[model samples]
Target: MQSSYNFWLVGISFVVATLASYTALDLTGRIYLLASARLRHAWRLGGAAALGVGIWSMHFIAMLAFSLPIPLGYDFATTAYSLGLAIGASYLALHVATHEALTAPRLLAGGTLMGVGIAAMHYTGMAAMQMTPGIDYRPSWFAVSLVIAIGASTAALWLAHTLSNDDARNVLRKRLIAALVMGVAISGMHYAGMAAADFPVGALCGAAKGVNAEWLATSVILFTFAILIVTLMLSRFDARTTFLVGAVSNLNGQIVRLATLDTLTGLPNRATLTERIERAIHSSRRQRSLFAILFMDLDGFKTINDSLGHSVGDEVLSAFAQRLLLCVRSSDTVARLGGDEFVVLSENLGSREDAGALAQGVLDRMRSGMWTDSQPLQVMPSIGIALYPYDGDTVEILLKNADAAMYEAKRAGRSTYRFFERSMSEAATRTLQIQNALHDALAAGHFTLHFQPKFHGNGNSLAGAEALIRLHHPQLGTLTPLEFIPIAERSGQIVQIGYWVVRETCRQIRRWIEQGLPSMKVAVNLSPRQLLQPNLVATMLQIVTDAGVQCEQIMFEITETVAMHDAPRTIEMIREFQASGFEIAIDDFGTGYSSLAYLQRFRVKQLKIDRFFTNGLDEHGAEGSAIVSAIIALAHSLEMDVVAEGVETESQLDMLRSMMCDEMQGFLLGKPLSADDFSEMLRGRMLTT
Candidate 1:
């Protein structure tokens, strides 16, 4: 049967062929240029399949509408096999060309192979057609087909040469223009090949000899040349754009690295810790898994830092962090919080016991020795554990509870672990309240000074009164020294309390002077820790100057322990105080390690014999007397006056007087009295006795 054709059929065929070629070019370009990950991967195998199918489809479709001079029967298997082989050859050429310099010459070679394969398929399908009613399909002359293939391949190579120049590939916008030009060229080729398949019988079949063929071929040539020009101007543009994108991605990765990691230890820093903890908390809530919040603080880290330099300290911390990380499971998170502090957020915990076990493992690892050049760092970590849901439901509560438990471990003694406890909260709250109350008490005039008079042994004359600090608790009538001394020492409020006592003592001495009660000496006790301060002399000078009283009028009393510590400084201070006209007394003499050498080092005005010696002085009729006499004899030999303390009875006093004690003080003189009661006792004693 002879095939018939119409103008509409040619136009429709031209349109269909052009669209098919354009789609093939676009898909082919994008597969290498901008395909998705999966598509890019599949392109290794599916790419060749796609190219072969595109050639076969275009060839068959062109043949369907044709009447050729040389008719050829359709050979589906041979055609597909031929197309697949050609496609594979073209791909191999492209791959080889990519390994060499991407120059115009290389592009021409690769592009020529692709063009020959595509053109041969189109022309062969066009030539294998019947031209008359009696004609059947026939194969085209192989030599003639080969000549056509060479001519088309050369033309395509020249076109590729124009498009693959360095300048052309550098500009992205120009490369897009190149892609558009190549699209139009391929489209024009489709239409021209269609026209070549069905040239009129009387008309010359070659495009040079007929209006229809010549017009279509000329249009194809013009389109191809236009594509070549556009492509040549934009090739480098596309390459440069791709390179810039890769550079930007590399820089972004570097920036993220610097921001997330600790430079010293190579661990995740606090910034990363916050992010990881938030994510872990969110995931744990979803998974219904418990996470342990562990706080690790290095014991004696400050001593290491201070003694060996921060550089060595940094090295130690880095090494220790590495060891710490090794002890935990990969599922757990470890990060440095700063300086010798680290934190671990362990998730997927089966129970509190699991967390404890993990914590114990970390502690054991940390406790191992860290060998250094200067010293082997024997570091022990104080671990604080706060379990999820039990200790806290939120990050803030968990961190707070963990911190509280960490301090508990520190207080229990460093290098241990402590789970959070509820009682700590109550105790912390109460301690805060008491601290504020102490500050207010200093302002409110709630503290007072009282005195216990000591009588001289010879004339029973009042030699001095020992100034005692007393606080009147609202609940308990009058609280003595036992109730508040400890609280003062711990809170460091003793400095302020000591200041109050000095001021009150001076004020009372002035009151006694005004009342004509006697201008005798008064001794105020000083705590050992407070007296060791470098600024003690300055503080004393200021307090005495502020009181506007003679320093000699207010004698300074120091315990045996205070007098012994830093003997040289104590001696220097004693000389300074004496130069400023203040008497220095050694209190609680026998209770401490008393040395006559300390007496020679310090210019002590008096030694207050401890209450134990005085109490036992009357214990045995002979033995007690002997003991008291020996102590008084030792005091006399040292050239220091003696004041016997705890003189509770007439017999105790009688024994002290017999031993030649210089003075005596205790409950017998009267229990430490309030200022008003003491004033009354002074008035009665001076007026009647």
Candidate 2:
């Protein structure tokens, strides 16, 4: 009788197994097709649970409907043993298969393997079930039983695929987690059906079939070995993969930082500067606000860098940049254009003063920095500020005007700021015009030299004549140096102009010397811009050598303001010139800082006091006399000669003579003249006087 019952169980199990296998194949294929590409990795867990639960439930329900003689006593140990083995083996298979690369062929082969495993587990579990007398639980009709088992497993699999394909999968960390939940649900349903099928009355009311000692013991051993192997594989995969991903991410961040940031100052570099400037311009136009661009340059920076090492220079620059940040409003943008050059774009300005005040604030703060390790370095920031929509609408014009103004500030005096002047703007336009005209001017030989005579006070004989610059405009008639000097300086044509001055001056001086005229020193004014050249001293010395003139015969005059602006550097240059056997004179002395010390610091052969001091002599009265006497005494103390400029009256000349001023230059002697008139004066003066 027991054997007959077992045969019936097997017979029903065969039909159920076929159904479970067919269901697994159909559902697995649907899940494979419908699940997201992203969640396809989770199929192993879902497929395993479906196959196991489908097989377990199919067999149990088939046994229940058959009314086969099952165990009368509780067979909890047998059923639990089978369930534990099926679940454990199915999980192991799914986990192991998931780790393999899931190619198209592998997925097909895996699904086929899963389908076959389900069929085998169902048939084998059915064969393991024992038939005994007096078991009350029985399966319902076959159609209803098949539907309950197969329909549930199919629904759970379909739901997982739906979650995988939709946005729901994004909520879970990995598709594998969602797969695990579905797996557990499917596993529980299958086990619940198993409990319903053939448990004793007390066991049926319990949560699950109670595990016997033998079943628990077997599960513990098998699960322990399976977990150990799985853990080992996971650890190795995690270590190598995590490290490689982390390394690649770190390297990418470093590369991005290098591309955007400056290496030296660690500021956003030129590439960033261009992008930001464009954006600022666009925003300004959209917002309808005024923006000011300030171009800043460190005055006399090259002197520090040349004398001191770059390390010290770099320290000074870094310190200066920090101070600059503190001076401006947070809204303003500051950037290092490169080297000692920096720029500031001040936006959202309510008034011109807002921009001006910000620029002035930056200058004040930059001046206050302790630049040198030895002493507090006083560096005047020469800033050029141009307002938006007023000075220029475009970034290029604003930047250009700001730069031009900065150069003008340097020319006026170091450590000062200047707004873009209309004249300067006009001057730039004139320069461009002149630059164009100069190419033709040089080719047409339109440049000429003029001379102004300087006489010895006591003898009234020719001491020397200064060579002046002249440009003959075809339409505008003759132009003076005042008209063209600025243009030449701006166009960087001063190098050519300076060379012409020396050559022409020497030529005139030599002609007079050949004509038996008195040998006298010819004074030539050298522009400060020309003197700042790195090779200026060398170039001048070469000029003197090439001209075949005695170095003493040609006097190179520089402005007192410029010399005092960079005293140490200028002193070094003056010493080089003096060493070359040339006479150095401080021109426009009184217009600058107290020139009383000029004779001592500078090896100046002559001092040309400015016209303003001379013009104010009568009005100042006794103070003027005292000042003139003091200047003459100061010049004599250092063994230097003094010249009074703008001596327009006999009284002015008389006062200068009484003060023992060695020479006088003004309208009193003669105005600057053509070279022919100057030569005639030299010739006529020697004959008459």
List the candidates' TM-scores in order. Answer: 0.46, 0.56
lDDT of 2 by residue, 1-689 (tens): 22123444444444444433433333333334333555544544554555455455444544443332333222555555555545544544444333324454544444344334433344344434443322243455323333443444343334333333213335334344444444443333434444434423322122124344345434533443344334334433543565577679899987886777655566565566656767777888899888888888888776677567688677667766666767787877777777887788777888889888887777766656554344355555788888877888776787778887887888888677788977788766665666666666665878887777777767565677677787887865676777777767755677777877888788777887888877768888888668767888788778878878888888888888878877878789889988998888888877778544544888789988888888767778888888888877888888888887888988888888888888888887888887777777778868886
lDDT of 1 by residue, 139-243 (tens): 343333444444444443333333333334443354344444443454345445543333344432222222343344345434433443343233335446656
Best by lDDT: 1
The true-versus-predicted C-alpha distance at residue 600 of model 1, in Å, is 2.9
CA shift of 632, model 2, Å = 2.0
* Cα displacement (Å) at residue 231, model 2: 21
Per-candidate total of colliding backbone pairs: 19, 5
TM-score of 2: 0.56
- What local distance difference test score does each model get? 0.65, 0.64
